[model samples]
Target: MGAIYTLGNAAANRLSLLLLTLISAEVLDVDSFGVFSLFLMSVASIASISAFGGAATINSVVSKFYMRSKDLASSVLTMSMLMSVFVSLFLSALFSPAIYDIANASGAYEFVFIYFLLFILSLLMAVFSSLEGAVYALKMAKGLLAFSLLGLLLSVASSYFLGAIYGVYGAIASIFIHRLYIALSAGRLAIGKTGLHVSVGSVKRNKEFALMAFRRLSFPIAAASVLAAPAVTLALYILGKREGVASVAEFSIVYQCFVVAIFPAGAIGQYLIAKSKGVLSEAVNVRVQAAKYLFVYGVVAFLGFWVAAIIASHYFHGKYEISISSFLLMGGAASIYCINCSYSSFWSSLGYAWPIFYSQIFMAGSILLCSLTLGETSLEIGFLLGSVSQIGVNIVLLRLTVHEKVAL
Candidate 1:
């Protein structure tokens, strides 16, 4: 399982580089690239919204209920599908204007909608796909990684071929197809392995549990999405406004790579959490474990990214405006932010939503300021500042969490 997880992470990072290279070589232009980035960022953040913490919800509840009835998790997933749909539609409508602008930049109006629709769809599928968190919760990282890697290959290949021919639209369609395959394949396979079935009757019996999940998950995940809003806006305002299409693509390349720490840190942390629940039920200790892993994953993933980016950055040619010093600075800072994501997991795992909400809002707001006002020098600096802000929040949260426990 561990090895498989490692493989999946490697695949994910590799796909990022592959996408960057292909975009640089083929359809990516400066203004067009920035628009692509904006869509990608929005899609990612919105994906989280649609997820509504369903993976965690499934992980937490399935363990508790399946002891009584094995089919319990699958039934709840049916309801989760409904909730995800609600969130996805709400967000699409809420941000349609912003989404429209991003698509217009690429001169692909239909694509903008297609990207958002697919983004929401893939995200929705991911939730159903996450019902397999039970598989993960049960320590089947092998299966988890296998399905994910397959999906990644399909996604990368699809985007490359389709994008070359149809431009950004084709690339997005490929992603849609790839994720669609993963979502379906993983969900069906998990059901077979778990021997679970989804029935409306069983879900009806578990109505209270589903509602409870919504209560706990919706706001917190929404808040996390909100916290990221500033960074997206900063990207749009400074890079979209200043750098144009080509610059946008390069920035997207760099930014996405920098954010890769989110996955490996999440992979290790979630695997541990899934295994440790109930058996290791101390909130204080959970916080400590989270903080420690945050640092460990951050350091390792950070270094790996720096080397990869240095190697890949040269391949993109004149697409970027980043200097060596700025790259190093942002790279280091993003490493720390990845660490912060781990601590965030602690709060999220514990279902302590308000603190997570407030903290992220504060962090994102601070990043927006630096990016918009101080952005004239370079986009890398803005990204660096954003990373620093997140790291600062994590450090404070860690100290406060530990100190409060010690006093008790």
Candidate 2:
């Protein structure tokens, strides 16, 4: 039942995102949509980083201590929330000049005033998002699904109307409302279940544990955020600068849709990590089963993405042009990335996260190289090359590390 709820929540969340993207693309002008996409990508990247790798680190720590000590779990949550807020504010202030530059150039200076507010809202959203790690770690799948569904409905409805009437600002405002709801819902659940005491006092008490947690998990947490958020945003920003906002718009649409294709793999990976917390043989069997399913799903999903791309092009009334070849390549790349996610979850589960961190560095370097050489045309190509490189390295590491650990 937990597995069922987990997958269902993932599906609902992905579908909601898909709908939001579709609606935004449909309602906003191409240039406006491009800016909106840029805003979302940038905020997401920064928020992920600010979350202090909460998705991985918080989840792992919460899971470890959830059963043994509720006080410790609450302490972890308290410390994470404090750090999330601090990082968000610091980053927001740091990026203020750039935000000003963009607003001034775009003649949207009035809206620029809202940037700081948006940053706070986005940060709160991210902190709440990090709390989901506790939910998943605790196997509160039903509660997760319920909150995700409610958030999705709120996001879709508000985004649709606000986007149609208010444009980008309205769209962002709507997103803020959605995030606020999730944060409240997830917050209530976490506090209710674990009795979280998120005071400065709690943080002071847990400072030692927080330091230990950061020392242990900082590398992978930072690496994962760098790869997932900022790296992708940087790629898209470069593409937008060199090729045009239209190119950014096209690729953003493709990437978002393609992500849905690989979400099942992500879901399975999380499940495996959560469930395979026992005997060595059992963990190996879990990985084997996960691999088989991912292989089959990836093949089918790659084909399905091609078909979906065609339909999407028409559905949007040919607003943005997407090459079938590029679309398929990106889809294929997304599959490999999903496979890497599985290995990452596996490594994190076993306290061997540094290998995943190292692989991301290698992957980032490869993508940066491609961007430098291939220029604007390499966005989709980078996706493919980077994924292949990361997956290859992770597989070798997984084999060597798992065997060594098992032998020991």
Candidate 3:
């Protein structure tokens, strides 16, 4: 039930996102859409920094601590929220120059203000979503889905209406509105259920879990800042430089489809991570089952997406002009990514967070190398390379989990 609710909600939300993108692309000019796409991608990447994996960290920490003391759980929640807002402000200021440069290059310099708004909004959403993860950790799937879908629905309605009238400004406003709803509503549910409230005393007392979470948090942010986020951003920049902004728009659409395909695996991974408890052998079995499920589902999803890509290419060919072949490659990439996510969830649940960080570094490096050398001609190839690199990294992580003795 948890898996179905989670996956179903994610799919609905992503579909709304896809629709929002399509409407933005249709209403705004290609150049504007390109800028919007970059902003969205930037949000995803920078969110890792602002969020610092706080959601996952809080989820892991709260799940364990709640059993012993709800106050500790609440303290972690407060600390996470505080940390998210602070990091959002800090990182937004830090990245202002880079944001301006990208905006100028995309021929949308004026949109930088909107970009910053969206960036900060992304931070808030990421931080609050960590609470959502906590809710999921407690197996309250339906409640999580309700708030999530409500946010998406509101976002889509506002974004579409505003984009038609205000163009880029309206589009971003829609995003901000959507994220704000999620942040507030989900935060409330998470806090009420987990007994989360601001307590300065509790914050100072719960030092151990905070430190552990911080240690786990450092790796993903480093990986994102250095490798994962930068690599994708660079690839998009390269594609824009070589082919034009329309290329960015095209590939962004393909990536959105990939997002839809991998979401189910991610949903299952979340369920497994939350439910995974007991002895080492039990954890091992959970990992094994996760791998098996992803393998089976990835294959099935690939075929479905491949077919859907063909149909979408035929329908959207005149307006979007996306290559069927490129869309097919994205489907393949999404398939591999599902299994990768499964491994990621399994390891994180077991308290071996370093492997995910290491693997992301490898994946980023591979994408950078491949995009610079081979992807000058085709963005699809760059994405394929990224997928391959991610799979390779997942394999390494899995091997380490199997062979080495970790005291999780």
Worst 10 contiguous positions by lDDT, candidate 1: 272-281
Better of 2 and 3 by lDDT: 2
lDDT of candidate 3 over 50-116, digit per residue (tens): 6666656666766777778877777766676666677666666555555455556454554466456
| Candidate 3 minimal-lDDT segment of 10 residues | 217-226
Clashes in candidate 3: how many? Answer: 1
TM-score of every candidate: 0.83, 0.91, 0.89
What lDDT tens digits, residue by residue, belong to model 2 across residues 155-236? 8999899999999888777777877887777777766756555667755777788777766665566666666566776676
Error of model 2, residue 144, in angstroms: 1.9
Best by lDDT: 2
lDDT of each: 0.60, 0.72, 0.70
- For residues 161-266, write the lDDT of model 1, one tens digit per residue: 7776776556656656765666676576556667566567767887777777656754575667666753665456466656555556655666666666455665
